[model samples]
Target: MSIIRSERRNRYTTISNTVFTNNQLSFQAMGMLSYILSKPDNWSVSPAQLITVTKNTAKKTARDGVYAILKELKDTGFVGIEKLSTGDTNYIVYDTPIAKKPNPYNTDMGDPNTAKPDPYKPDPSEPTLIKTDIKQELKSNNKDLLSSKHDDTNPSDKNSDSAKQVIQHLNAVTGSKFQCCKSNINHINGRLNDGYTVEDLCLVITQKQIEWGSDGKMAQYIRPSTLFKASKFSGYLQAAKITKLNPDNRPVTLADFDDLTWGKDLGL
Candidate 1:
């Protein structure tokens, strides 16, 4: 069976298929998560509000059902509850289940105003780098790449040095002339700011060249725009890492085979 999708240009939520395939979550929980994600980052709803919207708010059975779904969401790591001193509760919803301890203070979950100070931001207080989870890392990278805000650290002279090095490596492996222009720097800096080491970037370029270098059509994608894209970089890195682990997967060139003295051992 195939699923048809509408072309959503604006106000659409991007969710991973992992949520749907998650056997641990019920259909009701999935629906609730979709509804929560569809709203603005600052949008919040209370348990009482949900119960009140139910068929019979005055009945205990209806309230219990609401509470059960909420509990399931919480236990499954889709939501974290924070009770404020002012007696208002905030729900911290995540696109993916929490892998680490849920920091209630974390404001990256759909909030425009991030309460937690992110070092990856363009104008970080210090010239230091702080590694973050993949979700926050991707968000920071996208913001740095898209926004017009340029600082000394993120999209500045200091940042271009590393991006140049990455571009140089790409050129070295792919034999292509790619300069550290705005577009190239933006994509390279995005990955750099995401805590990917220089070695990681080099490995990705080297591996992609080996995989795509032979085919003329595929070789065109060896450019910075394709290699360092946000959606494709991590996956390429993972694949490159696997190739590094298994050296046997490397291409067997003409050097790998030796000319044999045929029938030398045969008593002809």
Candidate 2:
């Protein structure tokens, strides 16, 4: 499905909020997403938007200060970032480096296929580089099959089943018409413009419970009615954005987040 652009841009605010809490990001990260969501969508918004927004709410210069926040937000799974080719000369070549994922159990760094370690190895030293690489490889393999029996870190595929579940949950939760400071309820239709079912929406709430936070604070950011002033419901994760769909062939012209709310004393 194609992205529900322009007309359906506000519901993402609530989606990002729930995503932030369930994923364990700092309030600063959450605040940044809240700000990005408030801006207008035009292909993409740059770091300049982040810098301006952060500096405004927080008294510090956001120029140098935006990256760490961006990284944290990225790490916490609050935002989906894509490296689009900007025609500007300075930026034309900037997206060259793709973040490499760890390779298979094979630990040969020189080989094109082996998994590189997390945080790529810098220009290596002259001494024993090959030996060190082998040792690290052996250790990594053994740690999984033999050495450490207790593996708490999830070894799940990031974009796999559970991840899809997480996405569905997000899509379901944000599939509501944000009660913005206007009387037009057209955006709050009973059927989700983004195509979320009631069951799918509840699963997100369940998933949120599975993921805990360090702060232990209850989530207040997703209350759409409570936050009807700044932005209304934006569309959910448009599958075109996440799925590998051919842009020219996608079905939905726009997947909307408006009209996703479950009202009080309604819908048992």
Candidate 3:
């Protein structure tokens, strides 16, 4: 029986076309939101807990500041909160696609009886190497069954061409001009974090696709959601901007990004 592990987090929804989500939040707001969302699943935290403990735990920001931070996250739709009858509010955490899996639960070397036919029998002259022994140690016995699923029986199929086009596009935005080849698709996939969509990557080069390479035009492969993520990584805010100002409702700017210690670490 196959056993899927219990998930630590769950993504209720994903944001696509986040181009509209720019500069909507301040850095402090972003950090607070990240903290809230990153908590382990099943561990629902209350606002009082946050107001008292979390507020001054890592960053001696403030008790009231947590409220403001949560408010900011809610505005962006990154996280939501609920008010309990106990008057203790709780943060609503969403799952991201980038969750990790535990190590292989089991493994099998191989079954010799299932070796190739006499004409193409396993090479009795040599031993198998450790690295190439099993693609997935856990499911080694079903190797052939697994490979048959993705078998490219026809290289000239229309579907095949479309798939190749997508790969080329992925290569470009990944800073891979001509690197990740068809055989390395899994490797590339492994590196992509959840929450990233092909459209997201395309946005990173959408302008470039329009612009000329030495050739003339480059294609875009990133999805809208992924692009928004990149926008965030690039210091671009989602439509959820929080100027990071105080309750005074003052305006915050890029200049004050690192100036204030609102969310500075208190060394635990």
Candidate 4:
């Protein structure tokens, strides 16, 4: 590869070369970190504003995309996010990536799959237990099969009403304008046919809204194609179940973030 280098005499920003070599950082994360470092100290910009300025280089820039890049930098110790008392967030860029604390989880524990399994010795008294478990599983499967038949036999009018209710709940929580159109109704009906109740779909909507509503970047994903996706709906429904079990775990208000503790731990 041929390379050209330009020598700058003035109006330049100085940054560490380690950023370019860091395997932990993505190209987007590195570039965004460099851009933030180039700005004068105390220069503040929100993710939404940063998206506007980065349009030429990143045609698909959005609040969520910008937040992701910034998050990457923060995770790698190149930046820190501080939510100020004034309700504005501040990004603190490091000249060099900060040293990360040692991860206890990274320590090699012998491979789990290599561990020997316990020798199975059949318990004479356990036949009843095994039969009971098998009967319970079969009973559950039969119930599901019967429910699927019931759904298939339900009138179209009833299904339409159910779909409308689900969409109405989604719209109410996410501030979306989705209608009970054919496409949206089909998505809802598919989940319903899978033995999920309208309440289950509404629970998924409410749980996701609580998670993504205030998050500008994630807010855009609260749509029919994503929420009611066959591959994703079950996982979302499972999360909703978890949230319901611990209702108090929900975030009720905005709180300041602790980068040293939380940022590095954030998953991509």
Question: Best TM-score goes to which candidate?
Answer: 4
lDDT for residue 180 in candidate 1, whole number 0-100? 56
Candidate models: Cα lDDT each: 0.58, 0.32, 0.36, 0.59
Give all TM-scores, in the order shown.
0.36, 0.27, 0.25, 0.37
lDDT of 1 at 144: 26
What's the ranking of the predictions by lDDT, best on top? 4, 1, 3, 2
Arrange candidates by TM-score, descending.
4, 1, 2, 3
Worst 10 residues of 2 by lDDT: 87-96
lDDT by residue for model 3 (99-130), tens: 22332642544565544332212256753222
lDDT of prediction 2: 0.32
Where in model 3 is the C-alpha error above 4 Å? 1-21, 51-59, 85-87, 95-268
Residue 206 in candidate 2 has what lDDT? 27
TM-score of 1: 0.36
Compose the digit string of candidate 1's lDDT tens values, residues 1-268.
9999989898688887767875878987787678667768876554433433333223322333454566667777777776555223456888787754655755556745466443223344464322212233333233223222332334446667667666655653443556556777888878988999766776787677667764548868888889889999999999987886684454211111111121111100
- Sliding window of 10 residues with minimal summed lDDT for model 1: 259-268
Colliding residue pairs in candidate 2:
10-233, 10-234, 11-233, 11-234, 103-115, 175-260, 176-259, 176-260, 177-259, 235-257
lDDT of 2 at 151: 21
